[model samples]
Target: MLETSARLLRLLSLLQTRPEWSGPELAERLDVSVRTVRRDVDKLRGLDYPVEVDLGPTGGYRLGAGAALPPLLLDDEEAVAVAVTLQTAAGSGGVGVAGLGEAAVRALVKLERILPSRLRRRVAAVPVSTVMPLRAMPTVDPTALVAVGAACRDRRVLDLDYTAHDGTVTRRRVEPHHLVSWGRRWYLLAHDLGRDDWRTLRLDRLRPRVGPDGLATGPRFVAREVPGGDPAAYVASKVADVRAAFRCRVRVAAPPDVVRERLWTDQARVDDLGDGTSRLHLAADHVDGAVIMLVGLGLEFVVESPDELGEALRALATRCRKAANGTSGGRVGAPAELG
Candidate 1:
C-alpha cells in the first residue's frame, strides 16, 4: 500500500512536470504496465486531481489547474534560485509591492525550514543583489507588474489606469510589447491604442480599473519593431525628445566615453570633439538636479545654454564657498552629514 502511494505521488509529480503525457510514456517512465498506468490515472482522478485523458494515437493525459496550489517539483538548483530571488525581493521591499516584501519574507522562512542542508548552504552562498544607477525610483505595484507581463507573454491587450508624472490619472488601452527594466525601474513598451502611438509606461504608475484588466478576446496584436529594435533604446529616444525649459550643453575636458562613464551615462548624449574633449547635451526636469549632476562630474566644464543653468551653478558655487569659508551655518555636503 505504501509503495502504491509513493508511486502515485511520483506519478502526480510527473504529470505536473508538463501538460501532456501518453499512457505508454507514463508506463515506460514508471516501469509499470499500460493497464496499471490507466488504473493509476483513474485513481488520481478519483482523488479529484482533474486528470483529463484523451484515448487516441496523438492524445494523452493532461493535468489541469486545480483550486489549490499544486505541489511543485524542484531540483536542488531550482530550489536555490527561488530562495535567492525571494531574498532579493524581500531586500528590495517588494519593489513597492505593498505586502510583497512581507510575503517574500514569510515565504523565505517557510522555504528555509524545509530546505536540505546542501541547498541551504547554496542559498546562503548567493551574494546580495544590488539595484543599479538611481535606486530612488518609485516602487511598483507587483500585481500590476505581473498583469502587464502576462499581457506581453500572451500577446493580449491591456487597459490601464496609468498615473502620469504630471499627477493626472487616465484610462488607456495598449498592446503591451515588452517589459523593459531600466536601472531599478520597469517600463512597459506598448502601442497606445487610444493615442495611436507608442509609449513607455512606467510600471510604478500603472494600475487597474474595475475588473478584467487584460482582454485576450480583443484584437490580437504582433508588436511592431521599435526603433533600434530595442525597447530601452526606444524609451531613451523618447525621453530625450521631450526637452524642457532648461536645455544645457556642456564641453567637458575629457573624452566622450570618459565623460559618459562619469555622469549622465543614459541621460546625456556624448559627442566626441576629437581633441581630448567631449560635448554633453542634457535636458532635465529640475535645474538644481542638473547643476548637482554637472558639478558632481568633478571635471572642468563650460555651460553653453539657457544662462539660467549658469546662475544655478553660480548659486551652488556661492553656497559651497560659504560652507568652505565657515561663514555659513551649514557645512559642505550637509545632506551627506545628516546621514
Candidate 2:
C-alpha cells in the first residue's frame, strides 16, 4: 500500500512536469505496464485530479483544470524560487496591487509551515531586501488589473475612466493589448478607439467601467500589432515624455548609436545629425539633475537649452575645481545647487 501511494505521488509529479504524456511513455518512466498506467490515471481521476485522456494512436494524457486548485508539486529550485518571490513581493508592499502584501504574507506563512527543514534553510539563506521609497508609490486596483488583463488576453475592448496627470478625468474606450509593470507602476498599452490612436495609460489612474452584470467588455476585436512592434519600448517612450520637466538639447561628440547604448531609454532621445556627432534631448526634474546626467556620459557635450542648464554646468565645474584645489577661500557656494 505504501509503495502504491508513493508511485501515485511520483506519477502526479511526472504529470505536473509536462503538459502531456503518452501511456507508453508513462509506463516506461515508471517501469510499469501500460495497463498499470491506465489504472493509476483512473485512480487520479477518482481523486478529482482532472487527468484527461485522449484516445487515438497519437493521443496522450494531460492534466486539466479541475473545479478547485489542487496541490502543486514543485522541485527544490522551483520551491525556493517561489518562496523568494513571495517574500520579495510581500516586502514590496504588493508590487502595485492594492492589499496584496497581507495576502502574500498569509500565503508565505502557509508555504513555510509545509516546507521541509532543508528547504527552509535554503530559503533562509537567500538575502532579499526591499527598500521603501521616500514617497509612497501609487497602487492599482486589483479588480482593474484583472479586468484590463482579461481584456488584453481576449482581445476585447474596455471602457475606462482615466485620470490624467493634470487632474483631468476622461472616458476612454480602448482595445487593451498589454499590461506593463515598469518599476512600481503598472501601465496599459492599448489602442484608443475614441481618439483613433495608441496610448500608454497608467493603471493606477484607470477605473474599468462596470455594469450590473460585472465588467462590461466590448466584443472581441482582431489583435493589432503594437506600435514600433514592441509594447515595452512604446510605453517607455511615452513615460519619458510624461516625466520630462527640464528638457535640454545637447550636441554630443559621439555617434547616435553609441549614445543610445550608453544611456537608458528614459534618459534621452538621440537623433543622428548625419555627421559624426549626435543630438541628444535630455529631460529631468531640475537643471542640476540634467547636468549631472550629462556629465556622467563621459563625452564632450554642448547644452543648447533653458540657459539654466549652462549655469548649472558652470557651477558644477566651479565646485569640481574647488574640490580639486582644496581651497575654501572662495565665498563658499550656495548649498552646492544640485538640489
Candidate 3:
C-alpha cells in the first residue's frame, strides 16, 4: 500500500511534467503495464484530479483543470524561480503592475511556508531595499496583463475596444503574440487582423473580450517569430517612433553615446557632430517636462530654436537668481532676456 501511494505520487509528477502524455509512454516511464497505467490514472481521477484520456492511435492523457486547486508539484528550479519572482515583484512596490505589491507580499508569505528550507533561504536572501526612480509613466492593470497573457499563451484571438490618443474608440481583432513591458508600460506585440500588419498596443488602453471575432477566431494561430526575433526590441522600436505635440532641438557638449545613455533612445534622435558635441531632437507633450529634463542633464547646451523656450529659460534663470539672493517675494521680478 505504501509502494502504491509512492507510485501514485510518481505518476502525478509525470503528468505535471508535460501538457499531455500517451498511455504507452506513461507505462514505459513508470515501468508498469498499460493496464496498471489506466488504473493509476483512474485513481488520480478519484482524488479530484482532472485526468482526461483519449483513445485510438496517437491518443493521450491530459491533466485538465479541476474545480478546486491542488497542491503544486514543482521541482527545485521551478520552486526557486517562483519564489524569486514573487520576492522581486513584492519589493518593486507597484512599479510595473498597479497595486500588486501588497497582494504579492501576502502570496510570498504563504509560499514561503510551503517552500523547502533551501528555497526559503533563497527567498530570504533576496534584497528588498532596491528603489525605483519616480517617473510619471502610467502603470498597467495587473488583471489586464494576466488576461492578455493568457490569450497569448492559448493562441486565442483577442477582441478589444481600444482608446487612441485622440480618445476615439476602435474595435481591434488581434492575434496576440507576446507581452512586453518597458518604460513603465506594458505592450502587447500582436498581429492586427483588421490592419493586416503587426502592431504594438499599450495594455492600459484596452478593453478586451474573451470571445473571438466571427471569422478571425476560426483557428488558433501559432506564434509567429517577430522581426529581430525579439519582442521587447520590436516594442521599443515601435514606441520610439511615437511623436509628441511639441518638438525641441538642442545641441549638447557631449557625445551621442553619452546622451543616448541618459535619455530614452527611441524617443530622442541623437546625431553626432564631427566635433565632440552632439545634437538632440525630441518631442514632448508640453515644455514643462522638456525644460526639467534639459536642465537636469548638468551639461552645457544651447537651444537651437524656438524663441519661446529661450524666454522660458530666461524666466527660469531669473527665478533661480532671485531665490539664490533672497530676492524672491510677492512682487514681480525684473524682465531677464536670453540671447
For each candidate, give its TM-score against the true structure: 0.67, 0.65, 0.72
Best by TM-score: 3
Q: In angstroms, how far off is 94's CA in candidate 1?
A: 2.5
Of models 1 and 3, which has the larger TM-score?
3
Q: Per-residue alpha-carbon lDDT of model 2 for 224-335, expressed as tens digits?
A: 9987899977886677677667888999999987887666325467778988899888887778768777887889988777788888888778878878999745566546
Q: What global local distance difference test value does model 3 have?
A: 0.78
Residue 238, candidate 3: Cα error in Å is 1.2
Candidate 3 lDDT over residue span 1-339, tens digit each: 998898888889998877679988999999999899999999999999989886857569978667777667788888878878877778887656788888888987888888889777876776667467556566777767777887786677888889887889999988999988665678899999999899999898987765432122334677787989999767866776676876789999999778767773245567789699998876666676677777867788999967767777887898789779988863565553332
Which of 2 and 3 is ahead in lDDT?
2
Model 1 residue pairs with clashes: none
Instruction: Encode model 1's per-residue lDDT on 204-322: one tens digit a residue.
Output: 88884323433233445787887678787687556555446656788898997677667643456667899999888877667766787788799999988768888888877776687
How much lDDT does each candidate structure score? 0.77, 0.83, 0.78
Q: Hey, what RMSD does candidate 3 come out at?
A: 5.4
Clashes of each: 0, 0, 0
List pairs with backbone clashes in candidate 2. Answer: none
**Predicted candidate 2, C-alpha RMSD:** 6.3
Q: Which lDDT value does model 3 have at 261? A: 72
